[model samples]
Target: MKTELIITTYNNPKALNLVFCALQDQSRMPDRIAIADDGSGPETKAVLEKYQSYLPLRHVWHPDTGFGKNEILNKTIASSDADLLIFIDGDCLASAGFIERHIELAKPNAFSTGSVVRMNAQTSQNLTEEDITSKRVFDAQWLRQNGNIKGLSDSLKAGKASQSVSRILDRLSPVKITWSGGNASTSRSQLIAVNGFDETMRYGGEDKELGSRLLNAGVKGQFLRYSAPLLHIDHPRGYVDPEIVKTNRAKIEETRKMRRRWADHGLDRHISA
Candidate 1:
């Protein structure tokens, strides 16, 4: 299947650079990539331009609107034409087998969500493009030496599990699987069926709301926590507002209570044929 990668970003060009370096080493490269830019500046555009020659890339950007991640993502989704869609944050560095594993385990009528190995601010700051390109950033020893050892065991367990073990964990894990925009994949048809993400959503639980809708529509959520692991670079969330959080949470609750299968303020309203 033709798979397209969608990475959401704001102004963190440094982190995005590392993410691109990581993607450059994917076991299975995506057919295309679309940046879901939420009003970033010239720095991000420069980063995109730097890698444009090496990757099949498209930048879907708008004016600096305040925290319109869902809106930008919806626009990116509409712009992509690949049958399969893989989503990740621009600050998250994919492991070498990330794309390969996602494609290998992809299922119909279902979306896959994976785990992240988070880097602290110090560790994130210290990482270089060489570290990402060589995948030394995912090395347990490197992570430990860099002060990311707190969750090393869990990170290793998730990143190194065999396919059989991963499948077993997926089947038996007690944790409820949710849609994580950072490391997840689903077919374009399934997303469109549910009208993509709800544009009314702000920041918190927007991804989860879309997942809830998919679940209500009988699309299963497959947990890939032990297989498709990625490293999330630390960054500040300056846009997170308590009022917005409360509003988003209420929207999510409403979607759950109503079992909404389609979003009124989603792709249909923004996407053109």
Candidate 2:
């Protein structure tokens, strides 16, 4: 299958650079890396240009529209012809086996969801390209000694030993299987069946809402929380609004009540019949 990695980014070039550095070391590289850019400036463009040689990139950008992540995402999805679409946030650093793991677990009628180890500002700022290239930054012990560890859970998550535990936990874990924006994968057919993401949604619950629609369409979720780990580079979210989040939550509820499969305003408009 033609696999593509869809990374969502805004104006943060610094973190996006780090993300590129990590992708440079992927054990299994995607056929294409699509940047679902949400109206970023030149700095982000520069970052994308820098990694063009290192990564197979498809930069999909819109104008400086406010809070149009879903809209841009719809455009990106509609533009892509890849069979499998794996998603990650631009701030998240992929492990070497990240893409490999996603492919290993890919199944028909299902999407894979993974979790992240949140890096603190101190750790995030202190990271260098060398740290990522050498893969020392992925080590739980190295992080605890040189940087900050959120808790024991963070340590457990960062450890490579967690792979064995992840298989068990994936089946035993009680957490609801939702499409986490930080890390997730689904087939293009599955996404198109649900008509892609809802353009009306804001940031909060937008990813999960799409997951719910996929579920309504009889697509299941596969948990890979511990198996496919990512180091999330922490950054300030100035766009977050409590009222907007509440409104987004209500939209998700409406989708649930209706058990809707197709998005009212999504990829359909962008795709030619």
Candidate 3:
């Protein structure tokens, strides 16, 4: 299947740069890469320009409209022509086989959800483009030497038992596997069938709401936690507000109760002439 990688970002150019660098070593490269920019400054653009020559990239930006991630992502999703879409956060660096694993596990009428290993601020800060390109960022020994205390459990080291472990965990884990935008994949058709993400949602639970709708539409979610692990760079979420979280939670609950399949205020409303 033809695939596109869509990364959401605000201003963190450094983290985004590392993400792009990691993509350079993907076992299966995406047909295209899109930045779902939420009114970031010029520094982010400069980072994108630096990698334009190396990757098939595009930038989809909207004005600074307070936490419009869902909207920006909808626009980015619409802009892509690939049959399959893989979503990841700009703050997360892809594992060497990230793209390959996602593609390998892609199934019709089902979306794959992956896990992320959190890296401390110091580890995130010290990482260089060379480290990412060389795939050392995923090295457990290097990560441990550089302040990563979370060992094998959260490590991205894929082993021969990885697939079996992922399946076992998926079946046994109590955690509800939802569509995590940080590291997830679905076909463009399935995404549009549910009208993409709910624009009314601000931040929290927005991605989950979309997953709920997909489930309502008969698209099951498969967990790929062990196979497609991503390295999440630690950063403060200054934009998070309790009121917004409460509001989004209410909306998600409403979606769940109604079993809504398509969002009223989603991608269709943002389509350009």
Candidate 4:
């Protein structure tokens, strides 16, 4: 299947650069890459332009309005023509076999969600491009020493192990499979079937709502938490609004109660245009 990667970004150029470096080291590269830019400044654009020659990049940008990640995501989804679409945030760096694992695990009428080892500010700031290219950043020991290894699960996720080990851990894991915007993959057709992400949503629980809609549409969820680990570069959450989160939670609850499938203000408008 033709695969495309959709990376969502705002003004964080440094983190995005690291993400690009990690993608350059992927075992299986996507056919195309789409950047869902949400009103970023020139610094982010400069980073995109700099990597244009090195990667298959297509920037889908909008004006510097308020938070509109889902809107930009919908626009990017509308523009993409790939069979499979992988989603990630700009602050997360993919492991060496990330793309390959996603492709190997891809299925019809289902979506795959993975996990991330969130780095502390020190780790995120000190990481060099060489660390990413050499993949030393993913080493469990290195993460423990230089970065913050939160728990045993984070170490297990980053460890270089056999596919069977990862799969075993995945099965044993109690975390439910959900649409993790930072590390997830799904069929483009399945996304279109649910009319893509809800534009009315803010940050929190927005991705989960989309996954709920997919379930309502008879699409299943797959777990890739142990198999496809990402190094999530941590940043401040100044934009997080408690009221918005509460509202999004209510929206998600309503979606579950009503078994909602299609998004009311989603991809159809862009696709039709």
TM per candidate comes to: 0.95, 0.96, 0.93, 0.97
- Most accurate candidate by lDDT: 4
What is candidate 3's TM-score against the reference? 0.93
For residues 1-273, what per-residue lDDT tens digits would candidate 1 score against the true structure? Answer: 888999999999999988898888888899999999999999999999999999888999988868789888888888788999999999998878889888987889889988788889998888898887777787767777777767634644435556677667767777788888788899999999999998878888789899889999999988778767788899888878889888878887888899889998898867776
Q: Which residue pairs come into collision in candidate 3?
A: none
Better of 1 and 2 by TM-score: 2
List model 4 lDDT by residue over 27-58, tens digit each.
89999999999999999999998899999999
Q: How big is the RMSD of model 2?
A: 1.3
Candidate RMSDs in Å, in order, are: 1.6, 1.3, 2.1, 1.1
Clashes in model 2: which pairs? none
Q: What's the count of clashing pairs in each model shown?
A: 0, 0, 0, 0
**Model 2 lDDT per residue over 1-273, tens place:** 889999999998999999999998888999999999999999999998898888999899999779888888889989999999999999999989999999999999999998899888888988889999999999888888866577756766687456778777677767888889779999999999999998888878899899889988899898887778799998888889999899988988888899989998898988988
Clashing pairs in model 4, backbone N/Cα/C closer than 3 A: none
Candidate 3 lDDT over residue span 93-166, tens digit each: 88778898888879999999987878888887778888876767787677777777465565533332466676
Task: Specify the poorest-scoring 10-residue window by lDDT in model 3.
Answer: 152-161
By TM-score, the candidates rank as 4, 2, 1, 3
Off by over 4 Å in 3: 149-152, 156-172
**TM-score-superior candidate, 2 or 3:** 2
